[model samples]
Target: MTLAPTRIEATPERAPDMRLYESLVARVSRPARYSGGELHSVTKAWDAHEVRVALAYPDLYDLGMANLGLMILYDIVNRRDDALAERVFSPWTDLEALLREHGEPLRSLETRHAVRDFDVLGVTLQYEACYTNVLNLLDLGGIAVRTADRAPEDTIVIAGGSGALSPEPLAPFIDAFVLGEGEEVMREVVDVVRAWKRDREAGGLPRIELHRRLAGVPGVYVPSVYAVDYHEDGRVREVRPLDGAAPGRVTRRVVESLEPPLTKPIVPFMEVVHDRATIEIQRGCTQGCRFCQAGMIYRPTRERSVDEVVRAAGELLDNTGYDELSLMSLSTTDHREIVPMVNALMDAYGDRGLKISIPSTRVDSFSVEVADAVARGKKHTLTLAPEAGSQRLRNTINKLVSEENILTAAENAFSNGWTSVKMYFMVGQPTETDFDVEEIVRVASAVKQIGRQHIGGRARVRVSTSNFIPKAHTPYQWVGQADPATLRRRHQILREGCRRAGVQFTWEEPEKSLLEAVLSRGDRRVAEVIESAWRGGAKFDSWSEHHDWSVWQASFEEHGVDPAFYAYRTRDLWETLPWAHIHGGTEPSYLRGEWMKTLNEEITLDCKRDPCNVCGMQTLDGDCRHKIAELVQMKVDGDSTQKERLMQERERLMMLPVISAP
Candidate 1:
């Protein structure tokens, strides 16, 4: 008979040794990170709540504190009378060393209880580079690094974020993966954990029992209960469920509309990456950039009404005392009522010296109009994302942005008093050539010259490019990342060309891009590599100062795993991807069709305006048709002049051949 795995005892709740923690914090460079007493932060009696959630962002406080996703969950969990939420960020290298030397475990920020003591430890996996940090966080918290070693009473490890959609690489470590928007699924997870704990208190409950129940939850995937088989050449042959509770394909959860925005955001003690009041004016993009995973996963765009947005902005500013208010979204200018929304916000708070900021905008004069309305006081910098350089390459990626569109936007911004302009591009896109890369420099130079004509020497143009990595749920998911040598050569071309043209240029480290590609596309075997890498000191792989590519390489070799198989190998259309079992709203057929269109350099119309392109989101919730109809009705209900203008615009667009590239 096989003996059950050894059950580890759960940690008891208690306040940390304050004197030692204070001493350690005093020695660290950033003491405010561990200081915990931030304005608007929630703290409740340890025993008062039945469910205690320790929300962790596996990164430094400087960056994690700024993440709006974590903040939203924190707010949602804390609002419950019977539940509470605390936060924990990965300790910096210095603090990690100090804690290990002192034999102290990592604790939550609000109450100082060890993270292992919480009922649930919900980690946000925002990016692939943070995978190693998750292991470090669990180990530092005195919890078992792997799920198999955890006892029934140990904190349930659950992760949710964009990275969670591609959950295979981190599956072994995480007990349950929340597949999509955590707004509703989080409550379900907490309920399951709470129920399991109650059953354990009455009589011992097995860990697998809880796993089976969680697997049954919609939008929850228990990786342990699923078995994956590989063919002779090592491609995934099939991913079959071992338990009846788990579904063959875990569909992601979707929130119908973005409503009741999070106000009263926790004010950080010190600086963060983004220090401002934020409102997600919209959720999902309709532009359908083929390389964008967010576009594919967050299908059927949802928007908050203009009235709700203005109200939330007021509350956020009032609660946090932040001077700047950010209208956040995948594409902020795409909001139907964007102009009126800005006008209303300005009308309400323009006199209070409020600075309204839109973080994303399309490459058109309309975006400039939105920017001009917001930049009434100061025009700091105008930024645009023309994902690719040349028009042909752009068409391949379906960016649908032309050089003329970009230049027109630049001219409009400069004419309206903006001096500095920043344009973002992606190098190493699929089908990209040296000429395509060179076009980035030419475009930047052209924009700079246009700026010079308007604002003389004061005008500046900066171009920033990131190496392209194929994300899990996009049209480019089957393609291989460009090799480092090619990326480096392309960067050198941009650097030299930009230097000669007097345009500033910046590019990402190709090494980081390669690692991202591997982890994002990796399968079950990658878990061994990740754990080994963490053991070999691979935390903070995203940070330039701490990243050691040699360590990752050594880990790969030790585990007998080939990183090239995941990163640089083109997947056949017939091959089953590691994430094939996880449906991210978009149907595989739609994605395959988009890939074929991309190869042909064809473009797709924006479903927001034109007839539905049948991208498969319609089958999920019927939101595609409903949202499009709502948008039309909304435009038609406007004043006569505006309604007439919108009708004429739609008529003209409908006349254009739908498949033609702009």
Candidate 2:
């Protein structure tokens, strides 16, 4: 796979004058964002590398540098002597306008080379909302927006991330989709491309041959190799492989262990979304929240050793000079050795003015202890996701936390000098009710009362709710989302109820959530809708100010597709889904059984805390590699089936229409 000498540069040109680039910088806003003179950034002579890869994040500079996945790939690809990896991101609107006015193309921060000049252009598709941005970046790069229209000399466009799980929505725009983790697969992809590039340079093969070779890589989905068939109902009948290609099933990759720390994380000059070093304490969750795609997709919870985590944290802090570090996982408190880990972090870094944040923590008393230790001098606002208002509602979703535990946890947080606590809930869950919406307010009020009792009148209690979107590969994949009107009404009820109860409430706009739901549950047909929306002047839909719901609605209408069918209709278990062919480790039967249990208000126990119910994780390979049950004793916190039924009833009730006020 080594690059041939003829492919390498025969001679080096003198460095370009800084004055020319500086003059161009003066014409663009945030010129420094594109400059690649960062302290630790890797730069090699253009003639030295056979293949150049431009790894781009479709966001601003500060945020792009903070993404751990981007950094991991950046490090891995650059480790290859034959390939040079650079970075780029979407400029902010102001800068974008300036660049457009000047007719400037999207350029990499390292080499100042246009993205179109790279041998491969890799985009990280972290979220659905970033779809339009991806298109806009492609347009700026002077590349064809559709994968089918591009030639061999054009950069090979590839995408990966959480959004890759359901790549159909953006399939037409990207050349290939890398499912699951990219750590192992990305290096393999680079090697394949480098070999193909060498053969092309030697006049041994054509560019189409290169693509065909890449299409053969495991976990790579080249839409060109598959033909999508649709039913008269506009649903996808099948996504079949063509011309002796393999089936369209791409298995996700999982690293066997978390050793060999990703120490050289990119450091940014400006503030970013998550401006801190992150240590992935664990991957995946066992909570079995039916509506959560992350819990289902990243299964069989894998944990890094507590000692390794602590060592990584210290090294990252020293290397990056970040004041804050985040312990990332689905549930931080659920880690068996979390107490000792927090204690060790506090013992080591407490006096150094370092702040450690646990992004996701369960609603339990022990979480309060972990928070107290890490947030000693910080103005801590503890966040707990009860996911629903009532215990009955929680059980249906398999959120086993009881109302009493939430209250107790709130009290513990307030007692530990935390003045504010944020509780998260989701509207439009599979079996929600008006009473459940009201119960959200009731629970917030109860927690507020508890907070007042412990931390006095100055304490603040906030209830935050996000509209639920049905996602692929989860038990609720067969369920539909709530209509916009239903979501709006539910939001109003929660808002008014929280106001009356003297609790602060924050909620995401129903329209954005509705679109998210549509995209999340959509099939290959959505590729047209996304393309239409992008052509209709849609970009950065994730940002409230930039999002135009009418554009998406018009797109659906123009395509003669009803968003409701995807967003609001319950799917039959027998109905074929767009992503059914892509096995995400968990068996469909396991998810179907869980869905049936939700209907009966029957709750499944967490494999971490109970005997293995043979939910197919074992069938996939072996038992959970984390040895979850052995590490944490299974305890029945409360009644299971009764609670499940109550949750299901509440969910059902929330979806029912409420009579207008008299």
Candidate 3:
């Protein structure tokens, strides 16, 4: 017999105004966005903790509530007896207007307290398109948007996530930026802010002193304490530390293991983009794809043991009443014991009416088998990311899979009862040519043929190609972007090809990629351009209906900064890039070497099964080669006495040091 989930009774919140909320709830779409009585939500007493943190995402509630990083931080901070954390997200356009018209401040979901009342406001800068929404959120909170204009009483705004690696565009608005994985460093940040507050109450702490203290945190970057000098041509002459405590080079912080993360994630009241209890099967990828920023920034892949993963899956489903579970990773099929892990999960929970989801499988038949085993009724869509079309281009990008491998996987999916298939490809990749664009259509066509050959008349294919945006930490960071004209040509070529073949071809708008590139590679000089765009109504540029392309162009002209200089111009090896001083695990020399390999059309093997390529992540931890080798050897040596071997492996992994010097 199965027991029902234990529900934590809801606690009453201190109301700002009952009538105002009553009116707004009736008037708003999806009133659950502002309503806060979701089951299992934690709400400590207002005076229970010494420090208050408002964990905010510069996006909507359905979007922000799905972020696992913020949820982990919320659980970690609230678990501490000395600190409390609450959730806040950028309100939708309609709700923002109503709140502003009524003169109500942006508030937290837990206690209904104004955001300005919190001691620390940590916002996740996940995307460039959300910059304007950051200012809109700040203004609604009754707090000044610029860091320079903020009062001591205003909430200390800090930004992090992937965007923080190239944070110069947002430097003027965010008080501080966290540069790496936030799991381990978040508590350090909270502790520093807490101590600073204590000293402030003692009447001895100055703002500069607080900034200096914050700059001392392992992953924290205090932009105000750093001096940026630009040449007459708008390139950075130098980015030097003005304070002694701040390091001249701010390397991103890494969490050595995944064991310490929150296992029982928070459940949302309404539908989100991805609404499922999740288990992080692994962190980082060692595939060494040159164009992938996540591959370069997240180094020396670390994975959780299969036993730990199963335990967490059971607990999360039992605690949250979620009917689905997902084993999350950059590459889910690459896990050492993925087959046995999925088998174990399905064996345990398969009969309990739980659906398991996996994303971005390897281009192999084995991954298809894993998908088949997990997709109980074939009730979900199957997605594959070939990333490129021709084998030559695949080699250039270090996507080691071959054309035969892709068709074989598609064949497997179709034979196994998957009626629909989605393949992801990229345009404007480095060294891409017109022939390469044609090859994209050719590959999709081949995939569709394979599906049709197997599924008869039930084949449905979705082919999406997005423009390549050069990110800060990848090997292609120094390469010039494909101009709008080039992207338009490629889009046209793909459209004609897919149209003749009667396939669904969706491509990214070059305008969005242009703004993304400018924001990605721009320096502190680009801050005003972002401010100008926001002031000209550039909020929600990522959304199609709300995007104002004219406003972005006007903002660029107003700032007199040419988009081509940042987005279209190729950078020299010796140039002083904006994020040159911000380390992202892998060293620059390694990235340069990888770039040379890409130009040579060379391919790198996955280091998990091969010798270490020495990308510099080894200096952070022991090689991941040992990690997978040990697990495989353990399973073989134990002769399938799985429980004993699993326990031994889990203990060994948990005992490993979180960080180590080679």
Q: Which candidate has the highest lDDT of all?
A: 1
TM-score per candidate, in order? 0.93, 0.90, 0.92
In candidate 1, position 22 carries an lDDT of 64
- Tens digits of per-residue lDDT, candidate 2, 1-662, equal 11112112334322343345445666666666777656457666667888788998997786677688888888888888888888889877776676677676767777677788888889998778888899999988778999878876679899988788887888788888887778888988988888887777788575557667877887787777777788887777887877455556767666555546686576666666788878888877887888888888776777888789889888877777776888888888889899898888877877787788888878888788888877775756898999999877887888877787898899888877888999999998988988888899889999988888887788898888888888888898888788778788888998898888778999898789878878877877888888899889899888899999999989999998888888888877887788766777677898998898787776665666544555555634334633434323323444455445545644443422221110
Candidate 3 is scored at a TM of 0.92
lDDT of 3 by residue, 1-662 (tens): 33343233244346445567557756988878877657566777767678899999988989888788888888888888888888888888888888878898888887778888888888988888888888888888777889888866568998988999998989988899998888778889888888888888888665778889989997789999998998887789999999899999898888767655365566677988788888778998988878888888887788898888888888777778887888888898999999999889889988888888896688888888888888877644678888898877888898867787788888888888898888889999999999999998998888788778987667888889989999898889999899989999999999999888766899989988999999988999889998898888789878888888889899899989899899988898778899987988888888888888787776655667544666766556665545545546655675455444434432332322122111
Candidate 1: regions farther than 4 A off:
1-18, 625-662
By lDDT, highest first, what's the ranking?
A: 1, 3, 2
TM-score-sorted candidate list, best first: 1, 3, 2
Which prediction has the highest TM-score against the true structure? 1
Q: Write the per-residue lDDT of candidate 1 for residues 1-662, one digit (tens) a residue.
A: 12222111233344847568768878988889987868778777678789999999999999998899999999899888778899999999899999999988898888788889998999999999999999999999989999999998898999999998999998889999999898989888888888888898998989999999999999999999999999988899998999999999999988876649988788887888888889998988868899899888887878899999988888777777787899999999999999999999988887777888888988888899999998895896999998887878887887767788899999999988998999999999889999999989888999999999999999989999999999998988999999999999999999999999889999999988999999999999999999999999999999998899999999999988888899889999778999999989888888899999888877776777654667777757667867546556655675465446545553443322235321
Q: What residue runs in model 3 are displaced by over 4 Å at the alpha carbon?
A: 1-22, 622-662
Q: What overall lDDT, based on C-alpha atoms, would model 1 receive against the true structure?
A: 0.86
On the 0 to 100 scale, the lDDT of residue 288 in model 2 is 83
Show model 2 residue runs off by greater than 4 Å.
Answer: 1-31, 203-208, 619-662
* Better model by lDDT: candidate 1 vs candidate 3: 1
